[model samples]
Target: MSDTTTPEQLADDAVVVDVREQDEWDAGHAPGAIHIPLGELPARLDELPEADERDPLPIICRSGNRSGKAVAWLTQQGFDAANVEGGMKQWAFAGKPVVTDSGADPQVI
Candidate 1:
């Protein structure tokens, strides 16, 4: 797997998955992120876009820890996944755009 990507480094093909709970997702998450909620990931894998087993994906959570496990599991399953390093907390600290309210509006810090 590749290294984690920063908001500025996110490419068109880079998929961002948010593993936080639904309430956390409603509060705020990276713009363009797809919510899968950690607990539901196994059943929801089909919801993810098709990717090469080795293509990179950056997973985010409220903090970095949960995303690390996500990354590990995905990688073991032959899907290339990277933890967001600092997750949404870092994204917020860096003042990147976050999408709330069904993405009707984006909050940019």
Candidate 2:
């Protein structure tokens, strides 16, 4: 059996970093994910909690490209960061829950 976690395994306790631009974030993103936009990450490293330094931190973007770079950077910075496999697009395609400003706010179970 594969030990890989599904989107269902994601929780508030897991650190999910969104590295897209502010415009992208304002649109929609993984619920509970921390927005650190790639441009500011280098200078904003301190804002990330110490727990993320040791625990798994999943970096995400609209697609996986930017987050891949983020994963590399964070790993180099001594943080345990990983790319969110296929990013939000995959999450959405997989029928995972997402938050959007489409009038009614649906809850993710």
Candidate 3:
């Protein structure tokens, strides 16, 4: 089965990868999340931590759809990845930290 994680349950050391497009990512994203648009994932594999590192890799998008696909692909490649259920929407609703490129108020786009 595909691995999945909730925003509230994300681990402290987990590596968060935001797979939204540039416009969406610029609006708001988890602080420190790696910005790798889903379309660029295949070419950006090197940006992800190695599977042996054992740190959880939580993939997120505007909602959960894209991240779920990413989780499936990454898992197939042997990385310990999981879909961030409900994605940024749930994260913001749960009061999780978010940041914007211009220091403006964060919003899910």
Candidate 4:
């Protein structure tokens, strides 16, 4: 099984990849997280930051399900990746900062 990490366990400087759809991502996401919908991930793999076993890439979505699948695919492609358990919902619940493209307040969709 792939590794699963909770939002609270994330490092402040960790580079996070958000794999939700565009609409979901525009709704809200972790500050500074990269936006790459799951469907586009294969085509956009090069856009992701470099990662390794010691520093696995963090992938998240509205819920853990999508991110988990992403982690599986990424790992197969030789990327060290982990799924964010409970995803954006848990991240927001953990008091992590969420942001939007607009200046409006952010909330997980």
By lDDT, the best candidate is: 4
RMSD of each: 3.4, 5.0, 1.9, 1.3
Candidate 2 lDDT, 1-109, residue by residue in tens: 1112235456633557889887677666676778899989999998875544434777878767888888888878877776776777776677766675553454322
Better of 1 and 3 by TM-score: 3
lDDT per residue, candidate 1, 1-109, as tens digits?
4456565556533468989887788877775788898878888888876654664778888777878888788778777777887778777777676768776554322
Using lDDT as the measure, name the better of candidate 1 and candidate 3.
Answer: 3
User: Which residue pairs of candidate 4 clash?
Assistant: none
Clashes of each: 0, 0, 0, 0
Instruction: Write down the worst ten-residue block by lDDT for model 2.
Output: 1-10
For residue 55, model 1's alpha carbon misses the true position, in angstroms, by: 5.3
Please, what is the TM-score per model? 0.79, 0.75, 0.90, 0.94
User: For candidate 4, what's the RMSD?
Assistant: 1.3
Residue range with the least summed lDDT across 10 consecutive positions in model 3: 48-57
Best by TM-score: 4
Ranking by lDDT: 4, 3, 1, 2
Cα RMSD (Å) between model 1 and the true structure?
3.4
Alpha-carbon lDDT of model 1: 0.73
What lDDT is reached at residue 3 by model 3? 77
**2 or 3, greater by TM-score:** 3
Off by over 4 Å in 2: 1-14, 52-55, 100-109
